[model samples]
Target: MVANDPITGQGANGAAKAAAVHLESILAHGDRPFDRDFQQAVADRVREGARPVVQWTSAMLEPAPEHLLGLLVAAAELPSAADRFANGFDAAADFGQWFPDPEGAADHLASLAPRG
Candidate 1:
């Protein structure tokens, strides 16, 4: 399938994830023919994994939101936070865990903060 441009930085990441999903699905098929069901299942799995990354990249194209901006600021000061943000590009599924909303981002940032 054709994909978006690399401007949002998800082209390579999404391709890698799709490859992994295909590999896993093929392995799991285990002697079964790669039939229509198999193809559909693979498509579903890849779509599930890709949805968050797609959403995150779409949001990024818009003006930055408050919580996203806050997370960026915190990432500058917290190595863990920065790493977490960077890691999302590698495993965009993680974006689903913490990138969608203000509360999740704040909690993630707080957890990355150093103790007194």
Candidate 2:
């Protein structure tokens, strides 16, 4: 779990609560294209405007770690996706244990990459 404040170490709880509120606000507004301003608002609410506060769980690993590895490989291949997942992984590592085995995560993600 990661939070905006590394010193305070609120973990994901604060961010999760804020995200729920922001999601509710978005839903209340109905289906609409989220413009940059709206997107910024959501990001600000979640304390992700400057840096991301991600909360990884067993649920995210779902079914198996392979699923996440595949997703991470795909993300690593794209600039935008890389910014979110791959970069997020680096940021998560700064605060706490990002994964049980960083080497294993890298190997798993590598295995899922498309071979030439």
Candidate 3:
């Protein structure tokens, strides 16, 4: 998986733009099997300046699978979370077979932050 190029030329707020891009990429690949509500809750927390741990646990209104939840939490806390997720997914032989609904996942992730 090619690492995302650092976001640049966004003027004085380059760091925020880069962070946003990183968050988008991470959420795109990392959110699997979780519902839109969960994804949105995390994205909202991120936009609202919440810590990664807070973002991870913000949207748990009901029971979720423990292992999957742990993955999401860990990914949220890492700086290179998106690259790690993409690499892991690409390395897994059965990943494509297991997740045949990437379009749906992308759509759900997109809904988290609509373009103006």
**Each prediction's whole-model lDDT (CA):** 0.83, 0.51, 0.41
**Per-prediction TM-score, please?**
0.87, 0.31, 0.23
**How many steric overlaps are in each model, in order?**
0, 0, 0
Over the stretch 23-54, how does candidate 2's per-residue lDDT look in tens digits?
78699768777789887767665555223333
Q: Give the number of the best model, judged by lDDT.
A: 1
Which ranges in model 2 have alpha carbons more than 4 Å from their true place? 1-9, 48-116
Q: In model 1, which runs have C-alpha deviations exceeding 4 angstroms?
A: none
Per-residue lDDT tens digits for candidate 3, residues 1-116, read 11222231112232454367557756786746666876676565444442222222322333555544544554576544444445532232222322224453344334433379
Please give, for residues 27-111, the per-residue lDDT of candidate 1 as tens digits: 8889989899899989988888888787888778888999999988888988888898898887777877778899988788878
Error of 1 at 22 (Å): 1.4
Over 4 Å off in model 3, which ranges? 1-64, 94-116
